[model samples]
Target chain A: METPNPNIKMWQGNVACAEGALAAGCRFFAGYPITPSSEIAEVLSLRLPKLGGNFIQMEDEIAAMGATIGASLGGVKAMTATSGPGFSLKQENIGFAAMAEIPCVVVNVQRGGPSTGLPTHAAQGDVMQARWGTHGDHPIIALAPGSVRETYDMTVKAFNLAEKYRTPVILLSDEIVGHLTEKVEVPPIESLGLTDRKKPTVPPEQYRPYEMDSSDIPPMANFGEGYRYHVTGLAHDETGFPTNNPEKIQAQLERLNRKIERYRDEIVEVEVQYTEDAEILVISFGSTARSVRRAVINAREQGIKAGLLRLKTIWPFPGKEIEAISASVRKIIVAEMNLGQLAHEVEWATRRSKPVVRINKINGEPITPNEIFNAIIRQD
Target chain B: MDYLYYLRQDKMPHIWCDGCGHGIILKSILRCVDKLGWDKNDIALVSGIGCSSRTPGYVDFNTLHTTHGRALAFATGLKIANPKLHVIVVSGDGDATAIGGNHFIHAARRNIDITMIIYNNYIYGMTGGQVSPTTPAHKKASTAPYGNPDEPFDISRLAQAAGATYVARSTVYHVGKMDNYIGNALQKTGFSVVEILTPCPTSYGRRNKEGNGVDMMRYQKENTIGIEKAKNMSAEALAGKIVTGVFVDKEQESYLNRYNEVIKKAQSGV
Candidate 1:
């Protein structure tokens, strides 16, 4: 006896992500075409113009990323989407965004990698790349969505975090989730609570772009807003100019990490299901989490104690969450579509305390529920 | 015009070596902006990595010093997202033609409203004078000790071929002409490129025995050919001569204007 929601519709993961970005006040998108994530650019190309937003297909992924950062500094939310190879091409600009503290979102629809391993396939190979891809000790925010609806929600959350932290956030979607179809009820655009970067409250002449306050994040003034300032990829001081002084360099580098580390509680997110008395724990993420849920349910039905811990935020890695839940669970299993990418992290998070087993697949396919369920039933 | 009004005096003395013509090209830009009466806040001086890339930091505009060879890419986004802002890109021969060649041609093909100042100093002055794409054949650079093997690029011609609405070239020796060309490029409403043949005397001139900065400026005065005079010259006569004049200037649909039409059409839902 429930009323049918008129907004409910069948949406693909990539489509939902595009709609999510629109709903979250993302007005600029510059991207190149690649499999699995191409729909994001296609949908935005048609939708953004109608919404008075900007959408452009740049010359390549490097330009796409560069534009995304530029558009963000131009005082609008911007994003770009690509597969594995394109993602690699975007790293230098991504590092630029990190160093300059520009607010933008980068979507990496995970395909198999290490030089185009599989284009139209599911793989979590770029998980580490998403964290350390940009060749520096800068902070990052990356979220992996497990299903169609979560893709939409996480896409919104990704933008919010980007604005909140003044850093680029990665919407890490795999080919499986990106292509999957499921029911989604999109909230009205006005109803969606979106976050914008904090604007400078001081007079334009007195504004400093990187002057950190008590909140650790400085107000970002838009370009052409009368607050003329400098932004550089080099190590810069609070005034936002390139500086090579050792003391100033150390302070600026520390402040970049401090801004995110101080607020890790607000940034990290995860989901735990049925772990009250479970003896076996399954750690999973992205599309693999969808299959792991099914296997966990089957393991319970077969009278084995099994529960699921799904990672929503991939970096800053939720290591504390694993350690907190380690006391009760005797063993932990990581299931994914790559050859032990997150498994390595799970082992480290547990600090060699649990018997961590990995169920990895590198083929152009999703990890099957049977494969994970069989792992749960087997002892040795 | 008072130069200090546009410059961030606190950031100077600048890192440019004595007699390096980057300062000359920088003055031309400042003069052009002053003549136009454009608000400093409304201009974004974006640059990629090079000695010329440091031009943004010296000015009181919304400056962005980006990575190597990606200034055009960044400026494209800044302009498209906010059409009200005037985006100018400052790059060098290596930054513009070598590492940034792909973006250069594509930005021209799109015909976006960005004024590019290509300071063709013939070598990588910031990274210790490696041979750049514009380094003349048989020129001595640090990497080209036995003389450069690459033919130089005619930047103004390249811009004309790549669909730029305005293209011009001048050398630091011709300061008045450089300012005139920079002013004309700034007034245009499409992709405009002004290639300035400047000297990197400390690295490039010292290696090639071009004498000092004064000697290099004297060479530019002697070797370059004005476009009008070159009309009657034979191919062999113009082969080694640096042609300095307007190559292309015309009206065309800029990328922003065309994209605005797309937005209007999309809103109409026809």
Candidate 2:
């Protein structure tokens, strides 16, 4: 076993994300430079070749996404990083990966946008987009990291979920977390739990690429592994050939959906602080959660029963958990850097069980702790 | 080597319409692979959306039928990840030049070690006779009901200018030469493109009063001028003629080779 690096260093979130991907055994990265997210690509370009990995600056975001998926299918952990405009261009290929069940990670450093709204500034605007950006009914797994350290940790987790579920996973970090520099302790690589996609155990002749045996995920075969099988964006049967039959299509869609749905417990993660006996819950994620955390502390000092529920895994939305918290809390104050994207999700999850309030900021700025505190006090 | 072994026999009766030349191009590719005696296991066939893209489903290899025009992008990733595996991207004209135009030029510029075979049948046959990037100007298409207003792209020249190491053009009518070109492309170390002008009889032929597949084949044979022969011909003589043959062949370090050099340099801490 290799000894873990017991070194403490100050690093930016984007740099941490690159280091995290390297530690997670990601061997391929294809990306086009985009603001806020470009640092991740820049760091990986310098670091990957040294580690015997490959990195290519593709011509566009579509090709970047396509290349990452291809590298994953070719038996390597692969990733791409982009901001809003680039992320929009990647939607088609993202859908392709989702349909073909390719394991890859896409890191979108959120910027304000319907179209390039803010380049260097932060916004949690892509929350709903991360869940529904790709035009399809396929399952999605999105993780939001609140700090530099979490950016590093969640990048590794994103790759793990991608490999585990045989789907594209998104690491949705905003500009604040992406560019923020903080001290983080580097742990040993071995101590980090890693998951690789399962390969076919059967003989090459008997192997079916999409054949499932009790589990929703089928063992994936690499391109040069001798087990030649077809992969397509079209709905395919167990043999991995496109099928138009309604029953087969339904079954295939169900299997893709259930792979993430059935494994929701393992995929969905949230951090609850002081919510056990609190009357008000401040639900937030990514960089916005940083301010919410400080606000919760400030609210407690002011004699208000306020707590924070920070979401780490945003998609496969922790609806049941939110519902449970809503049953106890009198009101849910969802604070974010967008126009109440996740707040709407919280409201839908609560179903009027508790009143859900939104404290949104979309002027290309981070939500301050005082703003969150003010919202909390106003709710009281 | 039995070429049949490289086919998914169970998926026989492919979706291509009668007289479609995609099958001929596909067969030529298979024959070239057979001629080279490559291990089927070490080959990966990739394609974008169209009649040509469906060829991967019938071929017995690790095949990827990707989104429209993204085959080269996907194949680039696959080839770079596993340099030992031979990657081929088969695409249609529109799929390669329209939506995927950026990838095509960029892939050529990088000179990645992948074979790109474009089955340019002039029209988008699968999409119900729409005009494509290669559809000749004034040709009738569903979108261009009166006539196509846009000029066609010279795919081989486009690739050559974009820095491909090996670039060639052939028609489905010239099956033997098409096979040879494909084989040469597969053996090349850098980006190689073989743009074969296949016949879209059902969509393009019937609409343009081109008689049938046989007439289109005859037209290709009669109108195509060899590169060498066309060099001496007058501009007027070569105007309506299809100039076919190899346009570019030069040796250069491929993207993978250059990347490997970087890996070595980095690993040695130099």
For every model shown, the clashing-pair count is 0, 1
Q: Model 2, A77-151: lDDT tens per residue?
A: 999999989999999999999999999999999998879788999988888788899997999999999988888
lDDT by residue (A305-377, candidate 1, tens digit) is: 9989999999878999887876699989999888888989988888889899899988887888999999988
User: Once model 2 is optimally superposed onto the true structure by TM-score, how far is the C-alpha of residue B71 displaced, in angstroms?
Assistant: 0.4
In candidate 1, position A336 carries an lDDT of 83
For candidate 2, give the lDDT of residue A3.
Answer: 81
Please give the lDDT score at residue A354 for candidate 1.
89
DockQ of each: 0.87, 0.89
Residue B197 lDDT in candidate 2: 95
Residue runs of model 2 more than 4 Å from their true location after superposition: A1-6
Ten residues in sequence with the least summed lDDT for candidate 1 chain A: A185-194
Segments in model 1 whose C-alpha atoms lie over 4 Å from true places: A1-5
True contacts kept of 1: 0.81
**Candidate 1 clashing pairs, residues 3+ apart or interchain:** none
**Please, what is the TM-score per model?**
0.98, 0.98
Q: Chain B TM per candidate, please?
A: 0.98, 0.98
lDDT of 1 at A263: 89
Pairs clashing within candidate 2: A4-A188
